[model samples]
Target chain A: MHVPVLKQGDYLIASVQSVLSDADLVQLRDDLAERVGQFRSRGVIIDVTVLDVIDSFATRTLRAVAHMLKLRGAETVIVGIQPDVAFAMVQLGLTLEGVGTALDLEEGLAYLDRLARKPVKHGK
Target chain B: MENNEACVSINSAADIVTARQKGRALALELGFDGSDLTLIATAISEVARNIVNHAKSGEIVVSPMNHSNKRGILVVARDEGPGIKDIAKAMQYGYSTNKGLGVGLPGAKWLMDEFDIESKVGKGTTVTMKKWLH
Candidate 1:
């Protein structure tokens, strides 16, 4: 099953709608990285509203994806995390510390836009 | 211990997803709220994934239970594979044998109300957990 990743201007939006296995997530990571390079996108917003559960593996995969995007000059914002998923994440102590998160897709896009407008920080 | 139980085999990643789905549906039928349902499902996913990644194969059984004046759900995941040598270390956060995040066992334990594990090296392992309705 292919996850549709739509490109909007300088941002890419990918919505996760199905139960994703480790292999699927690995595929997504590769796909997103390739797409970001091809589109020269500056930001990505991953929507996970349709996902009922986000296990430790999935959380780690998201963090990895975000790190990979950052290395490629693209910022990633995860959006639409359900409240229960959030609760479980906290309970499990899988904080996803380095990943950015937003309440919804609109908010996530806004966040990316803000980041784009900000002046890049020099070596610090 | 109610007779309404659902069981699924876990041999691959897809089977882990199936187990979580069935577990979630059962939790919903037992009147678990949205948050509780998600918690239960996530807990199931953690253990089921352990089976697929660590044990290589296993089975998950979810059942409804009634005790004293409380109702709850029970999940039992068992595998006949290389059992954990140090069950204590396996239960520690960030202690994985396969370079994983190592949150599967401990995280599942925290998500549910009760958690138990029995394992013997070169034999097998079984995890039993329960979450009572609130």
Candidate 2:
């Protein structure tokens, strides 16, 4: 499935629409990471609400994508993980560790806006 | 589609989707819904992916089962690739011989109600798993 990545202000939003194959997930990661740099996006929101099964491969790939975007100086927040998909992911020992998550597109945009408002912190 | 069993040949990533799609259809038909159906489909994805990543080729057979009291879905993945030499070690987390997170096997095991693996070096491997409707 092709995931549409749209730019809003300084952030990118990728809304996944259907079941994704392994290759599709990998392609999305590469595409998002590349676009983050090209568009100079400040944050990215990946919406996976339509995905019913977030399995091991998908989980691992998404985690990697988040990290990749982080290194590109873009904050990543995964939004719209369904309740059922979340439960199944947990049951399969998959967790989106170290990745930011929000409820929906609006909340995700709000999160990015809040980050934009906060003063950039120095080394922790 | 009305049949109780479905066999999907696996080679590429698309086959994985097909198998899991078939699995989801069967699970839904068996009256499993919500997270339970997702669990089954996810388990199938993990196993089917293993076939694509490690075995290079395999087939997954999904069917419905009825015990004396409970009913569930059964999934079996078989491959004639380089089989695992150490089943126990392969089951451990963070142990991978390829470019994967090494969680597929154990994760699939965790999702299903029952899981079994049979393998022989230089021969083949078979993974059987089930998730019951509760």
CAPRI band for model 1? medium
| Cα error of candidate 2 at position A53, Å | 1.0
In candidate 1, what are the lDDT values of residues B1-134, reduced to their tens digit?
34469999999998988899999998988989998999999999999999998889989999999888999999999999899999989999999988889999999999999999999888889999999998
Error of 1 at B90 (Å): 0.8
| Weakest lDDT window of 10 consecutive positions for candidate 2 chain A | A113-122
lDDT of 2 by residue, B37-80 (tens): 88889899999999998889999999999888998899999999
Candidate 1 residues A1-124, lDDT tens each? Answer: 4568999988999988787877888888999999999998999999999888899999999999999999999999999998888998998898778888999999998999888664455796
Give the clashing residue pairs of candidate 2, or none.
none
Q: B118, model 1: CA deviation in Å?
A: 0.2
lDDT of model 2, residue B7:
98
CA lDDT, every model vs. true structure: 0.91, 0.89
